[model samples]
Target: MSKLPLEGYRVLEWGLWIAAPTASMMLGDLGADVIKIEHRVTGDPSRGLDAGYGSKTGRQSLYEGFNRNKRGITLDLSKPQAKTVISKLVQTADVFITNFRQSVADRSGLDYETLSKINPKLIYAVITGYGSKGPEADIRAFDGLAQGRSALAMQAIPEGPVWVRPALGDTVAGINAAFGIVTALLVRQRDGKGQKVETSLLSSLMFQQTSNLALHFIGSIPVAPIPRTRPTNVMLNMYRCADGKWINLYMPEADRFWPNFCKAMGIEHLRDDPRFKDIWVRAQNSEALVSVLDPIFASKPRHEWIRILKEHGCVIDIINDYADLPGDPQVIANNYLPEFDHPNYGRIKYPPMPVEFSATPGQLRRPAPEFGQHTEEVLLEVGFSWEEIAAFKEQKVI
Candidate 1:
């Protein structure tokens, strides 16, 4: 019922895959009019990507997930006629977002320098793989590559680095870019001046691990990869139960919950034991403590342990798999995974905007547009005549 936070803003997105589109998608979710520009012929490459969840209907979950709440248009930017269209769109856009490499952007005249010259007040957001000014600035990068370069992949066990799935680097970079764009919008509102905003998957990945990476940066220590079975804190680790289901505990203030935790586990005699008397001692003797707790946890099913621990006010939770999310009560109550009847995919769910605003809540007004679904409408909004639109279409420019 309330107007959304980003109402009255216009965003022009020239992106593919996840990062740049994701930024625009968030802006769209917040009520901005986001026009997603794609290649005239092929559209977004992700549209065809199967992602292992592909259906006989040829729907792409990846593209669908990232591109909702936006209008779609196509433009062959290489064509000179397309430049005229882009210039018109830029003049009316409050923000312009792209994740193209530097050379690609320059060649297509979508770089900040060129676009800003067209509209002096345009907030240009650039998402890159490395950064805008580094040695690898022009290098092409994807989620896996950025994660590997950012040392996130190396945080795995001694067996080797693990590749995280579902595009962690890209998603984080996109979220960071959206945050930067909103901050820039505030500055623009204050001074009526727009500037270039930049973020990279590498930088975002590093930011994600700031607390862990701080040890290496501040103490000048080479951080070793985490070992699978070696936990720094016994109380802050996961245990397998009698049913083979895993449950994780998080009593960081172990001393405060020591007696209650012991009572819940029916091991109150061990509460006063010197070897596990406090957080520090438990951490120091974590291996020994794990040995003591493992068999006890294995004595009960996950549900029983969960009930007992929660009854005793111990911080605990079950490790849910992907299939558990759709039915999760907390997830449903918070609307983290909202459902909609997609035209091609039938009934499905996608993640919505994570933050909630009491006064100005966001909404999913529409699904991601079909390829070039709004080209004519968007062109008319930007001041192109119907004749020009038809001519551009005849010339394969839109």
Candidate 2:
């Protein structure tokens, strides 16, 4: 057997969409025995939303990307019989997660009050749009809404504040929620009890904007158009090499590169030039300096510039796109991806857990399950007799 850090840990993921399920998926990545509990018939809405795979696997990309190691069981918790089944499963679960509105949890009897009592050591984690206590606690939220609310859009783009292509809020919230659960698990190990660990899109977005938040709080003006190209280091901007490929130049300010930055563009005399002397001066005269440096960089291909920069001890990195990612040396070096013999999708390439350990490493135990795949097996394990399980299935209750 492989040595996985969370080999025996059991997690019951009741999440529907990305933010909630992605959290459990991280636990699954860490080798937790994650059991995803979904509705009986419809299943998780994301499981079949994408089009390229046809009906056989609509949301394969969504599920395969996030849910690599968990088992699935569909239970209509809205139904009394399913709720009873869930309560029994709660007793055997180490963690429980949900993302519905507070009222919905309260109504469904799946809130902390009910489940925590069933299993006092359960690490209950959640991700919401707003918090459960704020004025908008009950209101539903999505990544775009949180991004718009957190002013993340305004920070990145000057004109209209564009969102990143993927859902940033959802991913951030999911990661935060997963960390909170892991933290709470540590606390439980120490105290022999569990507590609620929760995160919200609003909170995650706030965490993402710590610098901007501090600036606003302290009344400092924040500049716009915060692409990584224009970093705090004035000489460390994106430069188009002679080949017209852009690469990032990160370096210590006022170092060897500072002199070279000016000389490479035939502006060595600018080293003593007042407007090009210090970072502040360079920032103030950004247009003037870049105007000189930009063309020098545009003269060569990115690889050629990288070679020159390496020879000159200029810290730099090639800007990589998706097409250039598969062969990225570092990704392969760390074995950051796993190949799976998926049932329908053979030899699928799924991202492996990002964490590494010397002894107790994380693992990928199973492929994402088929819809309602473990309904009968899970219900039976929860103490439902065959006759009862058959009746429920016949009634469309399982």
Residue 148 accuracy (lDDT) in model 1: 93
The pairs that clash in candidate 2 are: 241-297, 242-299, 242-300, 242-301, 243-300, 243-301
Predict model 1's lDDT versus the native.
Answer: 0.90
Per-residue C-alpha lDDT of model 2 across residues 310-380, encoded as one tens digit per residue? 77666789987766766879877887666778877778677667667877777676888777788788777
Error of 1 at 85 (Å): 0.6
lDDT of all the models against the reference? 0.90, 0.79
lDDT by residue (232-262, candidate 1, tens digit) is 6677789999999899998777778889999
Off by over 4 Å in 1: 51-55, 220-225, 272-281
TM-score of each: 0.94, 0.91
